[model samples]
Target chain A: MSAWGMIKTIIFGGSTLAFFFILWFYNPFKHVEHYEVEKDVKAIIDNPWKKTESGKTIAEEGRELFVANCSSCHSLRYDGIYIMSVQTNPKWKNIEKTAGRPVYRYGKLYKDRFFVPKDVYEAFAHDDLQSLKASFGQVPPDLSTIYLARGEGYLYEFILNPQKVLPGTSMPQIFNPQFDPQAKEKVAKIVAYMKSVNTPPPQEQFKRTVMGVVVIGYFLLMGLLLWKYRQNLLKRLGYH
Target chain B: MGLISKFIDWIDERAHIREIYRTQMVEYKVPKNLTFPYVFGVLALVTFAIQIISGIVLLLYYKPSIADAFDSATYSIMGEIPFGWLFRHIHATGANFFMAIVYLHMFTGIYYNAYKKPRELVWIVGWLIYFVLILTALSGYLLPWGQLSYWGFIVTTEIPGSLAEAPIFKDFFKAVAETIVLWMKGGYVVTDVTLGRVFGSHVLIYPLILLALVGTHLYLVRAAGISNPDGIEYDKKKNPDKFVPFHPYITLKEGAYVMWYLAIFFFFVFFHISHFLPPDNFEPANPLKTPPHIAPEWYLLGYYEVFRSIPDKFWGFVAFNALLLLLLLLPFLDWSPLKSARRRPLFFILFLIFMFSSMALTILGTMPPTPQNAMLGLIFAALVFGFFLSLPIISIFEYGWYKMKTKGGQKE
Candidate 1:
């Protein structure tokens, strides 16, 4: 086969896709930036009075505080909830961190999910307080699973510098990076809330190791059934 | 005043390209029954486009000198340049995905009997592309000058060096490979020499070759058209001149499929980027240190696993390599009267085994590549050989016996 064929295919296919990208990415009319915020933040917005820690440990206290202070825009799940993307705001760099993600954990869900509060927040800014008190157009994300999306270091630093990390946003910088704000007062408390929201890794995932054998067993049964089914089909078709 | 006419003239001159794109492309109608296996070809194409475009942008900022090689790459991504990070991530991420899709596509070709005679060159060219991709990945990895990139270079290139005919040749080969290693240090050895070469290859040589090869692969694919599951060529013999131009038929079909694949690719690009690639690659390459585990690209994990599981070095190397080389002989080994797997009974089972073995080996390779992994590696390697290379022969033999028994021992 001619190697050029692959090249042409890519060139042709990619150029078409690039056209789509031009539409998807370069939407000037789209001024309202959307982002996927943290889950606990969303939970607080959905129902601030919803039970906190009603379960155990520091997580319970963290949830209560999170629902009370946060939850306006943040989501309770790992998927993205539209907040704000920096590309929308021409003056995003000029604003404070309040336009992006908030610092300090309002609840347990915000602790572990690293990228939302940092990576996502750092990438965009909020446009107005109407969006802010309402949690930007995007729901704040649940921090419980943030670390898995971003990383520990990124999350930790985000908690340290919410404003500097992401310039514009409604998320207030509760922790001071210069003096290293109260361990339990600012970042630590938020982290505790995030930790409280953490759930154990899925039990079914651990069973994947045996998934190979499980698949083989499934195939074995299916193969046998298939042979029988084929035989039946053959009979119906008057082949044999 | 004459832009439209000028465009018409341009099209007239490159009429073949226009015809190829507009009409000839749709001539060979690809089977609409293709499932997930069909997406790999499209995925491979996407990867090449990403590599080429990102590679071009990166080339603008990447420095080939020893002092700034790694930093230039770092800047291209995270620095002041516009969309540098996106380009870098896309290119970097594209490498991993390309290799994976290539392997998947190659396997799909084999399992579906798409590499029978006439399309032998297609498979061979694909294999060549595989080699190019490996080189591309090797050079691209070092662009970062990180610990993984550094050691990754040493471990990978060492394989070819070991096959050198003479000691002097071997030493020279190693030295030549290590020249960039020296320059990467900002010295000789691996410090700076390696990083410089890596960045140069990543930005300059590999991307150009990749572009050329992609064109060739596509041309042949379009010229030959997608191989039917029946392993029949799209020619007078099988098609019997009942051909339709590619303009609307296949183009529409491929276009529809392309959009579906794009939806999936975009989902991963935005939402699942981290899971597909490691974060450490984002940092600049460093030569002195090593990551917790030294592993090959996910595609090579199968052989790496086999290599680790075997006790003897010679046998390990042979077993590890045979896992891939095994496919080149499939055209002959496949003795099924019908080319389609639907009729070919036993060969299909063996194909699945070959696939599973490779996948299993990749997981094993992620672990430490050490002597203690002998049993696991040996078993998997044996399976790889049995499943990939020997399965067709085994199927031929088994079917021959069944045929004989059913025919009451008639020699004819």
Candidate 2:
């Protein structure tokens, strides 16, 4: 073979071999690293908070708890400038102090004591943002989305024993010591709340009926087109 | 056939539909030498239809308010509506595949120099379609209001700010930049108004404009006729046999390709759900937070790399936009009488270099602006623009060389 031809062979053949070798050895899909959780956690579970009337109550309770405990640092809504401030502001320590929680001002007669904002009170009981940020050391992510990103089992375990699931994390073991008596119920409520807030998007299901009809319809159309094509070719060939 | 013909005649007499059909479909002729590359235009049309149908269905369930947009997409369309997932996936995945096919179609045009002579307007309109599609995709990106879509628009909106420091008319340019930013976001920042406007543009305005552009494009195509693969001019007197009606022959050929394309498209839509639509997008948009790294959709990675490679934001933005505009001007830049790369060895090799550099730039675009990637990106960006800048010079030189050789009777 010519030198150039040999070079082309080496390039194409070697690359093909290399690609397959990489695929075999380092298959990304096969080696996907799932989020690891505690031994008891299933790591992968379907929505644990089943949609029921009781489940809705538990979720509502969890929403109250989340606002009191989590919302001071985190958020549920995706809009507003506070979110942007959290992202762009580097002086978080300073902002945490001066940028006090948005509160409703009753009047000067109230001695400027912060009234829980009407919106916050309307949504749920308000928490002191200044205190929460000091404890957490940084702004916590919007927990409203944790259910979407994580399995329910993981959330349940993480909330039950945050230190157990994730070491050196700031999430206090709210259940291990106090909520332990009703830990399962509390965990369920929180999970239900997270699930309620972050509802699993209605997913695309395989439309078997549509697929069946489409496939059959397509084949029927294609067969007719092909038959006409063959007849046209035959006519062109003088096969009247 | 008889009943259909009778029905068609009945409508034709009242609506004059038969003449339109006869001119556009039955008598529309394509080159006999057409290959798989030629089918990309038809595939683009098919995917555009898919996008429109799927998008309309999605719009039925989609609420465009900021507070509700994300939930409407995730809960209502994805979770609540029956087969909503399929429509959403088809629309989302169809956009990606449509852009892919459009690129392939554009590349085929560029490779064969289909923009030459009488076909320049067709190429220009097609390029405009492509430009509008980019806007359509980006505007639709904001509708989902997910973290990725939100942050992606944030990163994109920053493009105007890059123009703030333009050396000439720095104040005026800054004002122009601010106006563009305002126009896009509709306020100081991205909010409900932004979502409302973007949603309107994506669903209503862009599609109508795209439809109009597509109509003009098809009119031009019908007028000019499809070019041959060899880049030779059509000679009616000598090459009557080279013409074929587009109905059965081309339609059947394109139909097979459409099936293959749809098979692959549906394969991703069904089997590989997250491959086209990233899971990062599932997280609701947080105005307070940006993702660790922001990137455009995968299709825009090549230009995105060029955008990020330069340290200077203004020049980087200019270079990135120039990359696409240069492609639009390829026909004019290519001064050679010879259209096809088949006979132009040097030009063919250079085209290969340009293609590889583009791929390299795309890879680089996806990576963080690490020092090594930045260096490679700068080099590849140079190679990409260098090819466009030098094409006319090389074409003139090549043409002169060929003339000299032929005049000297070097060829048998």
Highest lDDT model number: 2
Q: Candidate 1: deviation at residue B45, Å?
A: 2.2
> Chain A of model 1, TM-score against the native?
0.32
Clashing residue pairs for model 2: A83-B287, A83-B288, A84-B287, A84-B288, A201-B79, A202-B78, A202-B79
In order, the TM-score of chain B in each prediction is 0.79, 0.94
Model 1 misplaced regions, further than 4 Å = A1-240, B1-23, B26-36, B65-67, B159-188, B222-225, B232-245, B282-286, B332-337, B368-374, B398-412
User: Model 2 over residues B79-98: C-alpha lDDT tens digits?
Assistant: 44666877987998788778
Q: Of the candidates shown, which would achieve the greatest DockQ relative to the real structure?
A: 2
Interface DockQ of each model: 0.03, 0.09
**Candidate 1 docking band:** incorrect
TM-scores across all candidates? 0.57, 0.76
Instruction: Give Cα distance to truth, residue A117, candidate 2, Å.
Output: 19
Judged by DockQ cut-offs, the docking class of candidate 2 is: incorrect
For each candidate, the alpha-carbon lDDT, in order, equals 0.54, 0.70
Per-residue lDDT over B72-116 for candidate 1, one digit per residue giving the tens place of the 0 to 100 score: 554333333555655665665576667756876887787677776
**How does the DockQ of candidate 2 come out?**
0.09
